[model samples]
Target chain A: MEKILLKNLGRPGFHTIDSCLVNGGYNGLTEAFKHAPESIIQMVKDSGLRGRGGAGFPTGLKWSFIPKDPTIQKYLCCNADEGEPGTFKDRGIMENDPHLLIEGMIIASYAIGASVSYIYIRGEFVFGTRRLEAAIKEAYEKGFLGKNILGSGFSHDMYIHRGFGAYICGEETALLESIEGYRGQPRKKPPFPALSGLYGKPTVINNVETLACVPAIIEKGPKWFSSIGPEKSPGPKIFCVSGHVKKPGLYELPLGTTMRDLIFDHCGGMLNEGRGLKAVIPGGVSAPMLNAHELDTPLDFDSLAAKGSMLGSGAVVVMDESTCMVKTALIINRFFSHESCGKCTPCRDGTPWLTNILKRIEYGNGRPGDVELLESLCTNIFGRTFCPLGDGAVMALRGALKNFRDEFQHHIDHKRCMVS
Target chain B: MFSDKAKEEIQQVLKKYPNRRSGVMDVLRIAQRERGGHLVKEDMEEIARILGMQTVEVNASAAFYTMYNVEKPVGKYHIQVCRNISCLLLGAENLIKHMERELNIRVGETTPDKKFTLSTVECLGSCGTAPMMQINDDYYENLTAEKIDKILKDLK
Candidate 1:
């Protein structure tokens, strides 16, 4: 499949309005304006595009959830808080091709009848922020964003909002709360964001990569998109492969690519020819780690789910035998501990305890039951939390223990790390 | 107090939203930038006054978020190194220790002369470029000791 989303990947001046126009940018929005809003929504519905932000919800179905009759207000939020430990694909689109996201947002807002859109970015992404800010400015100056945009009598304004260094804000509700200038915490669902989000109006929040695919779906019909990958989850997915690889960067390919192909063929293999691969965290740290021998697992949502893992944000972090499994578990525990939003007891309390146990085991001090205790802690925290953060932590750490119990046992019995 | 220019920018930011409460984060960012990389009680109070919010509310906001630096000053260069999983796998911890030995300041400590402040941050979404550090607004990726030395020398 050709790269629809990143078609302008390495183009010089790709961020500028001139280059965007030269390369047929905003053509989707122009073509979209020619169709009735319902047709646009219907086209997306037939595309079968799932949300690329880890939760594989159908994008068109999500847009259809907004109330057809305009109510008090509506909002379109672009989740650019790319804070997942191993996920960096969103930042690539934001930095390399900001205009694509802008065009997608325009078309999406039109389809959803939204008058305003906001790009909520991570505070650590200062570089992406600069590029997006410049892109938004150029978009506005070219009448692509404000005051009857392109003479279609549809006016939409866009802004770039920044989170103040919190990973939980990646949650859509938490993102909504942060944009509302409160403590970034997740709210109870049942009134999901589609109905009441972003200032209690009808809202549609999408991941940066998810929204970046919209313009293409609009330009090329939904049938063309659904044909790229497997029937359920189809599209050009960008995999972020890093660590223990020679060519560690973004590789845009069709979905259902095998893990071995991505790591070996695309990323140039592990540490070296002699070094044996130990494990692969196929998704972000939130997802479970796949053992070295499970390289044949297809890099898609259903395939990974069938394998007791997930294709979360397409973050493929590989580690060779030289890497310590205990330390890896400890590092992930620390990340979840520091990022737990403290909204619930399971996540807020259990994450730190998990971190503590892993730290003690990694530091050459381990009790005989420490491994089982760790398992019990993960069990207590897994499904009981109010949000998925708790469940995500349990999946990652618990997955590590189940797959690398020998490594953990080595730490406990020998009272030292196995790698060193 | 925000300068007139900053006040105008804050107002413009506020104009982007319908409710003044929604503009709190951006307002705080403006005040932090205007006050030279940190926020003070008076600055929060001033922002509260401008946005029709309480001083305690503004102060709590500034304290809750990690990006805002308060109660202390950083050096001319704030070197925030990444220490997350991918980064750690690629030896970010040792690189941080190397930085400590070279700079003579531990993580979270500023140089006595205020020329450098070394700290570790969560994943900056640059895991693809592991063992990376951010100095101010720029990301210095694919790091090594020699590259660190060059970056430090260039910073001066």
Candidate 2:
């Protein structure tokens, strides 16, 4: 598919304001001012846009949830804390065409009646932060931001807020807590961010990729967007394909693209000869791994969910036949264990237990009932935790066991890795 | 004492947020960078006084984040290797092991002279270029054993 979101990427001087303007940049902000904020929301709704961050909630529905009251302070937080293993698309947008995100934020904050917007970015994105800061300054100087923006009587202030390396902050509620100068922990979800968020005010939080898509959806009519992909899942999507692939990088495919095409056609296939594809983590570590045969499945939110997986952050990590499943499970669990935040007991306690058990199995210390113990632990951790972190950690455990039981069994029975 | 430049930067960060506390992470980073690459207890006190926060809160905030160094001063070269899923799948383990052997130090140990400190971090978001490591602010990716040799030799 022709790239709309990443078209400005790698273009010389794209990060600068003049370069972006010359390439028909802030025109989306201009296009947005032509309609009422309600009409803008309605257009996004009509576009059938879904949140690109792990959750596939409808973008328009999420924005519409903001309180209609004009008295409360409303906010738009851009979740750029892209530390999810195997996900790297957001880094590209922030690094190359930062003004695109800045422009998207202006249009989105205006639609949601927010006077302020914050880009909650990952601390590891040092280069991204510098470029985005420059973009914000440029946007401010051009009158695209600040009071009476573009003379539309809609004022929006944009700022870059850096996160100090925590994965849980990627979750919206935890992100709000981090923004409020507290530890990054998930809050009880009775009052969602749309109602009371970011210092107890109405807030609309969105992923960097999701917000970056808004300007284009407004520029092109909604009818043009919904016609691009599957009716239920429309619009272009950026898949961050990594791991053992011939050409592992970001592939911008229209929605409903098959996982097989992404790996074989788009990414150029497995790493090398005699290395057949083993298992693939369809999304970030949070999503279950798909087997070789399951590669034919369509890569969309509904399609993957039907197959007991999710199009989470569209992070497709491919592994070759030589890769060790047991070791992969161990490493993924360790990531969750290190970043659990310890807010709630289920996640705080369960994550380490999962990692310890996986470590023992990988190192050939599996006991007789270890498999059953893993199953039981995953069952307890899957849905009982406060946030999805608990469930996400177990996704690797569950998927590895379900698809590659033989490899795990080999380690348990022979007390050695089988892949080599 | 915070440098004049760091204090000015802290003030600018404070002005960016409606709430003063929201700039805690940035202030901590600046303070850590300015004060010989780590936040001492005294530095935390200065941070608390500047942000109008409790010293304990500032210390707690520093401890909560993985990037901030409060316990000990980091070496001039802090080698952070990414052992996350993507890099792990692509020889990141062997690369990490290679570095361990080459440097004659373990993952969590700093050299006696404090020139280099080695640690394994979660992910640096450079999955496309796997087997990557971050030394200070720069990322060295698509690394080979040969690449490691050259990088270490140059740094040495």
Q: Which candidate is the best by DockQ?
A: 1
- Cα lDDT tens digits for candidate 1, A82-199: 9999888998898888999999999999999999999999988888899999999999999999999999999999998988888989999999999988888898997998888998
Candidate 2, which segments miss by more than 4 Å at Cα?
none
The true-versus-predicted C-alpha distance at residue B96 of model 2, in Å, is 0.9
- Docking tier of model 2: it is high
lDDT of 1 at A64: 92
Per-candidate DockQ values are 0.83, 0.82
Model 2 error, position B85 (Å) = 1.2
- In model 2, the fraction of reference contacts reproduced equals 0.74
DockQ of prediction 2 = 0.82
